[model samples]
Target: MVRRFGNGTATARAREEALGKLPSPRGRLPVIGHLHLLGSFPHVSLRDLAAQHGRDGLMLLRLGAVPTLVVSSPAAAQAVLRTHDHVFASRPHSPVTDILFYGSTDVAFCPYGHHWRQVKKIATTHLLTARKVRSYRHAREHEVRLVVAKLRRDAVGGDAVNMSDLLNAFANDVICHAVSGKSFRKQGHNKLFRELVEANSSLIGGFNLEDHFPALVKLDIIKRMVCAKARRVHKMWDDLLDSLIDHHASKPASERGGEDCDFIDVLLSVQQEYNLTKDHIKAQLTIMFEAGTDTSFIVLEYAMVRLMQSPHLMAKLQAEVRNTVPKEKDTVTEDDLTGLAYLKAVIKETLRLHMPAPLLVPHLSMAGCDVNGYTIPSETRVIVNSWALARDPSGWESAEEFVPERFLEGGSAAAVDYRGNDFLYLPFGAGRRICPGINFAIVTVEIMLANLMYHFDWKLPPRSGAGRWH
Candidate 1:
């Protein structure tokens, strides 16, 4: 049932005619397109390319025979994310996401449609609502206590902890507690959860030839690794959800029917109402666990790195947090987070600098559409470069510098915000496809950062150059 279009056919002709209306590319390389110049740091390379090509630069990347379009400016991003959102809302099918996300049942990777909408609604209403996120304050506090306790012990001996691992563990614990009402550190635990978390993170960050070349998807060596990991993760998720469902079902109706319901309780209610199967519930839980844990960890890691590199910024942040939060408090409360303006600015800056998913997950055009005078054929894959847009000089001042002040009052940079309105600052993405966990993520990150700053003073390990802390 797969249909192929010929260059000389009417479909191609119509596309060419549509292309005539859009902004033309300033330049393009041969068969490889801009691949050679892109190298590993595609974000920076694309930024430079856009500077030379102009705001509406369009380039054809020969990602195999398919000419994938990479849009690098705010205007172009708006065209893709805002003006033509519906036309390009469907996700590009990938072997990793397809298998890991239960054939794209999750909110982040699901193609735009009824199924995606249903999944997103459940996430927003039951899992990521502000009330739901705030209800897990004890979990967040407990995990932060563990993180700080461990860090303090390590710092006592002047030990250099691989912050990456610590942060990953912190995020994983918080997410697990939030989603399952349990922590990975619980006694009598299985190692499957940790294994699946590691594998999922690796798959996201690891290079996969299959993403760019669909024809070679089955032939690629990474496919085997992906399948193995997927099977393991699927099994673990199935077991975990089965237990949660059973536990809730066993609970008296009085306990389960209360207003204080967890994610599992919410899903069960939905299942009964919609007459959904256990498999559907499992698919939803799997997506939430994998996506929630990995993304929050990535952002936290990036924030820590940026703070380490900018000591003055760190000192200022710490001072602000200490001044705002009392030492007697065992944990920083959600209300405390609101008063810490600088902390919010720091997080916003980190996200602006390093959006975890730089490409914002590719979307396929369901139907032919015209954007900025270019004709996009129906079924053509489109990628929105949120990473590039965040740093576009046109949108931000000194875009490369680590200046959190840009988000403060009266700063040169305007408050574009991240609530799906500004395409330039879409770290959570935009339109109907925006991430559903945005509220939960913000609360978790803000609370953690505030507590860390309030509780301790951080410094680079001895013998390491001061340059490490900048």
Candidate 2:
């Protein structure tokens, strides 16, 4: 019979006794709890511990001074991502996300509540809507032209190109143009933007021990890196936003109020509606750029890498693109995306294999909650390892393999959607906090990947062994 715990019941006592009897951590070093066990890859270490402890088991680790619970199974993921999504929706406060997100003013890292909702709604309806995203088609085409030009140069020179860097530049240009009506190549290009983008991406991969353990935040070396990066990024971000605000202020009322509304315009409108301060507006812009830019770039990079590693998949994807998209077109139109199911599958497959925010930003339990029979205490920092869940053998057939066809007909694979409902495959996360830019991201990746494949046949550069680049 199943057991229940509450109110000092026998089941509660038994559960406590069992927990007490569990072996003490092997050892703990001063100021760094179980850091040795984490080695270099903390995620791998957590997975090993979870496997030993059984699915849904909790392994307490002191990330610095913070207590963290790493949940590694699909069932546990469901518990955290679904059953108690509200409790886990709020992001943990950390120096890295705090500074980078303009003190958590942005939607991605903001704590769940009225403030987050306000920002999220504006982002969804005004900035990231399908129609708004489509308006940026010119930006996509312009960036792709630059990418093709570079690739052509590489092809003619027989030089090995770092496909990752190429894609990064492409993503940067597209995002810059979409948000600011400019390109990375625009006047006043500097290293600050690059550093800021790199720092944000690295931070997502879990570099700051302070994030997991707040007590030791001041002593964290990673926090120092974050602080330095934040200073540079915040300056660039402020300048950009201030320029937009000033531009709007100087423009004629009709030009400012009508179809000329850009991301900055939407933010200004929201600022007026909510009576937000200038700092708040600046903070929101910082969030949009930080969250939207690198994540899309990383996804695109991983998609290309996976496609390169899997030739059959690449060929199949190319055939689908060629069949659906006309050759004379410079780029695949958004309308063309609907007919490219295989292309969608490839993107989904890449997301499955490489979730940009693998853990989906740690969610804190605002209040006590019951999940899969476990009475999770209030204030427990809940983590959902979407990476493990996506790769779980039980949830997916040949989960680790790069097989886009598994998503096609007659396949035994489970349904994997970016929409927030499916806990097992939430690349953009699940619940009300789901990323608003999912549609934009999907279309951008699809169009970019389609154009690349349609225009050129990719090959490992000559004299550079497989996977090597100049």
Candidate 3:
């Protein structure tokens, strides 16, 4: 057999790859760029943009001062996030991140490089390892029981329990325990954390005006408005984190104070090893608490919402959770999750339909790269719409429906996973910068959902009670 390298096909392919311009929407404003196209729900708006303009799966839009690339399909997501991950490994800088995350020193916003890699390594290996996460089994179980107990107490008088607030509190308390070895609720700091989480979500959710129009923010009016909000948030974050760190620091070396010697203790012990300063520790703790509590609870809340929407699916999950745990068992253990395959499938389905960060954290291109024969230049803010990708018709059957069975053993979409392997199903994202909290998040969400389903039967509020169930 002879292999010829002199064919015109090779040269033609190279030429095509080299000369391609990124597909962009038609109406791009001069200074504001595509900022006008983005509305309150940018994910939906951008998804529409990709559908109309991104015939090749990648759409280039100028977002204010930044050139942004939106990856709306699985194949394109894989190309950008997996194939040429290193080029798109870094995170794009935004005023929102800088102000909220203490100059983006935290893991999520930290620029991709040596410092990021070091912090990531420390977190994955020491803080969030499978063994470390599993070690907190008691803490998770304890919190879940508290959730069940509270629901029971509410049910005693036939009273409606607000799962939203209670679940938020449950997640907050669990994360507080894991982070600092004590419950923030008991300490009366849960309200502050709650406010911070709400603020972070609001600021992070939509397109911030200051982020898009950086130059416009230089005006006294815009600057003061933005700075005022940022300062208030920063002060709250600073005071709470300072108190948490101080509490841990005041502990005697041998005492090692904390519930199960929390993440705070772990980070403090290795502070010298990582050359970490107080700000660094605070940033890390802030991220851990903020991300762990807010995102996990949101997922749980949505899971419950979805379950209540369909009684059939709810019954299926309840049966799995109930059968997996013995009738006499008061709490569902982590080991029991292995046999409860359908419960896991329900969680997957929920995430597929309602992703936490619909548009994942944007990636920055460290250098120019070619995606699907199009050249994405350096410093382009790359966004993978995990929400759109999850619901893409080609990849998922009954794309808009809530079908948990699709992720079950014999189902067609069973092979897809959330652990960054299958690009089409990346609820957590992919590549070198994939979320490091996978183990922690999965465990927290699964346990919480399992207990909620197992212990109590949920009911829709009477006012909105219609034919929601199937």
Pairs that clash in candidate 1: 18-375, 19-375, 21-373, 22-372, 22-373, 22-374, 23-372
Candidate lDDT (C-alpha), each: 0.71, 0.70, 0.81
lDDT, candidate 1, 1-470, per-residue tens:
12234555787777655544444344445543445566566666655655665335565455544556778767777887788887778887777777766776777778888888787787777778887777877778788888888878888887678877887777777776765565234632324565676777677556565665567656647567546666666667667667777876777867755444667777877886655577767677766766677677777877777787678999999999888888788778777887898899888888888777777777788777666666677767777778888877777889878898988888765466878788788888887778888877777788878877887766665664533210
> Which candidate leads the pack in TM-score?
3
Segments in model 1 whose C-alpha atoms lie over 4 Å from true places: 1-9, 16-38, 48-55, 183-191, 216-229, 243-247, 257-260, 462-470
Please give, for residues 1-470, the per-residue lDDT of candidate 3 as tens digits: 11112237775454334324677888878888788898767788888889999967888888886677889988899998888998889997767777777878888989998878878987898889888898888988988888888888889998777888988988887887888775465788867787787777777764577766678677988877876776688788989888888887898977663436788788888889998888887778888877888778888988888888788889988988887799999988888888889988988888898878888898988766667877666666888999888888988899988899998989988888888999888888899888888888888999989988888888677775533221
Best by lDDT: 3
Clashes of 3: 1
Task: Give the per-residue lDDT of model 2 (tens digit) for 159-249.
Answer: 6778887787677666666665652355543234555667667665656656656655566575565477656656666776677667655
lDDT of 2: 0.70
Q: Tell me the deviation in Å of residue 296 in model 3.
A: 1.4
Q: How close is candidate 3 to the true structure, as a TM-score?
A: 0.91
Please report, as a residue range, the 10-residue window in candidate 1 with the lowest summed lDDT: 461-470
Ranking by TM-score: 3, 2, 1
